[model samples]
Structures are given as C-alpha cells and as structure tokens.
Target: MKTILLPLLIGLMLVGCSSSPSLSNSSSLYQELNGQSGLERLVDAFIQEIAGDEQIFHYFAKSNVDRFREGFITHLCDVSDGPCEYQGDNMIDIHTGMKINEADFNRVVELLINAMEAEGIPYRTQNKLLARLAPLRPEIIHR
Candidate 1:
C-alpha cells in the first residue's frame, strides 16, 4: 500500500507513549541516542536512508526535507526521554488522509531500525525505543 506525505509521518511513532520506565521516563535512551546532536544525526541518516530506498523515495520525494529533519529530531529526543518536545502534528492529524497501510508503516519502522543500526545504537537500546513506540502504532496505521 502506498500513501502521500509519508515522510511527515516518519516521527509519529516517537511520541504518545511514556509508560516505559527504562527509556520513556528516563534520559538513558536519550544518552544512548547521543542526545540532541545524535538525534539530528539519526534523522539525517534516516532521510538519507529513505532517499536511497527505491520503494520509499518516491513517497518522500516531494517532502520538506528541512521540516522532516527538525521534527524527526525533536520527536526522537522526546521519545527517548530527552529534553525536547515533539511540536509537530498529532499522529491522527498527520496521517488521517494519507491512507497509510500496515506494510508501508512497517517498512518505515524497518527504515528507522536500519537508521538506528547505522547510528550504532545497541540492540538493547533499540528494543527499548521500539517498545516505547508500540502504543502509538494504533494511532498511525490505517488512519
């Protein structure tokens, strides 16, 4: 399934949950993400990853690269319990008319995992971050 403005929805998974004690309410995951600068780097790499993916690039080809970068970084920080807030649109609002489906949403998750791996984030830290992201899934897919 394909969708429009998928890039704007990239960081939607990074917010809306804070129940996890290890990563969501603590700065440990943020530290693992290398703080603000590291989140920026991760967003940059994620954009590059999306740009290089033939399957995904077309969806992002018309996106505002700068906005995605900044929003993604801020969301990453917020999601990782860093000192930042995700000031972008809510998940439902951002993805409502896009018609995003399960496969595409999962693909984006895969891309995020790839970006995290490229950033040298450990498997443990990565899992923690993913776990934090689980609850927000319902707000995103098929919206």
Candidate 2:
C-alpha cells in the first residue's frame, strides 16, 4: 500500500508539471480583460460612444472604422500584456497632424471610461488599463 501511494503521488506531480498554463494560471492583464473578445467589445463600445460625440466624430470621419477597431483592439491587447501584435502606425505618426488638444484628449479619456463602464468592466480593472495607457498622451496630443 505504501509503495503504490508513492507512485501515485509521483504521477500526480508529473501530470501537474506537464499541464499547459490556462487563463486560471495566468496573471496577465489580457486575461483579466477577458482576452481578444473582451478587448473587441471594449473597443466597439468606445468607438460607438466616440462616433456620437460631436467633439471627436470629425476625427474619425475619414478613417476606416473596421480597421481602426481591429488595430485599437490589438494595441490595447498588446499594452495589456496580451499575445497580440499591433499593426497600426505609432501614436506619434497617427496623431501628428491631428492637432489633438488637451481637452480633446480628456474628452476621449472620458468617453473611454464610459465605454468601459458600458462594457461592465470593473472600475479597478479599467483604471489598471488606463494607467498603462496614460503615458501615451504625449504622443497622442499634438496641441
């Protein structure tokens, strides 16, 4: 009985070590954001809110919405430590001629917060993501 128990415990330990890491074992913010699907939803909510806001609608007038959504999701995912690559232009290049002011940037941030709320993302998680993104303001705000 003792010999059998020893082999069983060793087998269990080997199985545990051989198992692949899952979301449950991951501490990535991407997992916290629910991965690609959740990020996609968050981006959609943000775009929808921005589309109706007079102050920012014009900014997207000449843009490709679908591509923007995809890239935004990728960007957010990458920033959140997810396994996604951002294919969009760098923030500096993207906003170079946009002349986005502090007020404009703030408004977008507000809209993003609203979007996060709309998507049922917790406030703490939202703040975590926002904190990660706050450093990009210098590149995004041209004026």
> What are the runs in model 1 whose C-alpha is more than 4 Å off?
1-27
lDDT of 1 by residue, 32-127 (tens): 878888888888888988988877777777789998788878887898888888989987887786677788878888998999999998898889
**Could you tell me the lDDT of residue 15 within candidate 2?**
94
The Cα local distance difference test for each model comes to 0.81, 0.90
Worst 10 residues of 2 by lDDT: 20-29
Lowest-sum lDDT 10-residue window in model 1: 11-20
Off by over 4 Å in 2: 1-26
Which candidate gets the maximum TM-score versus the true structure?
Answer: 2
Clashes of each: 0, 0
My TM-score estimates for the predictions, one after another, are: 0.77, 0.80
Which pairs in model 2 have colliding backbones? none
The residue-by-residue lDDT of candidate 2 on 1-143, one tens digit each, is: 99999999999998998795764365778988888899999999999999999999999999999989988999999999999888778999988989999999999999999999998888778888999999999999973
